[model samples]
Target: MEQEANKKRKIIHIDMDAFYASVEQRDHPEYRGKPVIVGGSPNSRGVVATASYEARKFGVRSAMSSRRAVQLCPDGIFVYPRFDVYKDVSRHIREIFSRYTDLIEPLSLDEAYLDVSVDKQGIGSAIEIARLIKQAIKDELRLTASAGVSINKFVAKIASDMNKPDGLTFIGPSQITGFMEQLPVEKFHGVGKVTAEKMKKMGLHTGADLKRLSENEIKQYFGKPGAFYYRIVRGIDEREVQPHRETKSAGAEDTFPVDLTEIETLNKELERIGALVATRLKRHNLKGRTITLKIKYSDFKQITRNQSLPFATDDLEVIVKTAQQLLAAVDHEEKAIRLLGISLSNFGEVIAIHGNSTQLSLFD
Candidate 1:
């Protein structure tokens, strides 16, 4: 019965093509077919949010520094993001998705996962449902979307990116094994540049190579995530599409313009990062019992240290003090630090004390 249900599971991953840039082009006829870069000013310390296909041709990409984007594509038309407009568009797309299935999990404003195993529209085929959703978006919103249909989320997400703007690809159970085997290790979701380099060093360059390692051997080398890799390579992703998934964590990180070796400078940086996390916690009305400090060395090696407090807190002083304590335990003196980040997690209902008076918990 379990095997039958797994076989019957139908998932679809939808992603908008260069969402922000594409929206800009769609609204402005003059910008169509031209490079569009949506982000901060090139003169300031900002990064690219999204780049149009035309800008991508010049090697400009999201998360890249605006200064570098300009150097790569000098003629690129840079524009600030209009998040309000994007959110409105996202709501409209969600409305279209509701016509098919309510089991929709939004990954971001421009991407989502839909479990159309039993679509409300009475569609028996997931592929057909995906086509209808895409057609609806194009017809109603005048926007193009790419889709990937498969039996599981992992396969579906990978398949969706196989094609570009206005593309739809499906991976059936029979095709999953071969499709994953030929995929590069770097192409696997959650495998970053650092992990990919480590995988390559271990002679694991493709999904096939990863599948050869036993679960125990993979875990021994890569820890918990290794077990995940072992199963995913064999097309075993049992994770569900959660529509109302809670925010597991919220944090901020910044890559420095230059690596800092001085303890004083590192401490100052941590103070700023801690304050940012605290501000966000207050904004979201969240309190967390665990505080995590993340550090990346000049060589790109990263480490995270976490400390759990007796009670959840959103206090700036508490966050800063906890982060400082965690930083003290790390051997930062041995290496130059290129990045610093602080995050709070392990959230639950707890008494929130404000100005010496207890207030209602946000979770309540």
Candidate 2:
């Protein structure tokens, strides 16, 4: 019965191509077709948020240092992020999505998962719905988007990235099993660099290789997440397109241009970060019971320390004080710290407003 119901489901994952960079290009005609890198200036310690396809050809990628991106694509143009404009554009895009189905789960400002199994327009065909959505984005927004249509979210998301800008891919129930078998293990969405390396070392290079292991054996080797791998490798994902997903946590952090050694300096930074988190929590009417401090050393090693309160609170003073205590408890007196962060989690019961999901959501 479950298998039959799964076959009847129609899922679509839509991802805007190099979203930040593409928006920059659309607004600035001069940047069109050029290698546009959006984030901080190359001279700063900031990282690339997004790089145009042209820049990607030169090995530039998101989260890479802006300095490294400049080395790879000397001709690339750098632009500061215009989040306000991007958010407005994203709002318009979601409005377009609503014409088809209210079962839209936005992943970020530029991507989403839509369950069009029973569409608002009675389109009946998921492929047709995907095509129409892509056309509408291009026609109305003057921008292009890529889409993946399949029987499940995992397969649809993977299909969405199979092609580039303005591409559409459909993976039907009949094709899903073969597609999974031939897929590279690294290409599996949740498989990270370290995990992929471990899989390769074990001669588990493809989905088919992973399929050889029993569920218990995979768990023995990979721990808790191995269970997820065991199921997805066989193309069985039961995750839903939740339109009103809860906001699990909220926090803010910054990467400094130079490492700091002084505790005072770290505390001041924490004050700033804590204030940001408090403001975000207040904006969303949420108070958390756990406060966590994240520290990354100059050498890139990272660790987190968390403390839980008896009562949830979003007060800036409380957040700052707790973070400072966590810092002091750690042995960071001699270590040069490159990054510091604060986050509030374990909210007793709080739901983010629709369409305002966290950027860290796996479905996004």
Per-residue C-alpha lDDT of model 2 across residues 7-120, encoded as one tens digit per residue: 888999999999889999999999998999986578764557789998999999876667788999999999876656777788899999999999998776788999999999
Top candidate by lDDT: 2
Among all windows of ten consecutive residues in candidate 1, which has the lowest summed lDDT? 355-364
lDDT per model vs. reference: 0.82, 0.85
Which residue pairs collide, candidate 2? none
lDDT of 2 at 11: 97
Error of 2 at 78 (Å): 0.5
> Cα lDDT of model 2 overall?
0.85
For model 1, how does the per-residue alpha-carbon lDDT over 1-364 read when each residue is reduced to its tens digit?
5334557899999999998898899999999999999875777545577899999999998767678889999999998766557767888999999999889998767899999999997879999999999999999888899999999999999988988989999999889889889899999997877678889999999999998899999999888899889878988888888998776776777788798888778787776566556535643446889999999999989999999999888766677778888888886658998889999999986322334211111111
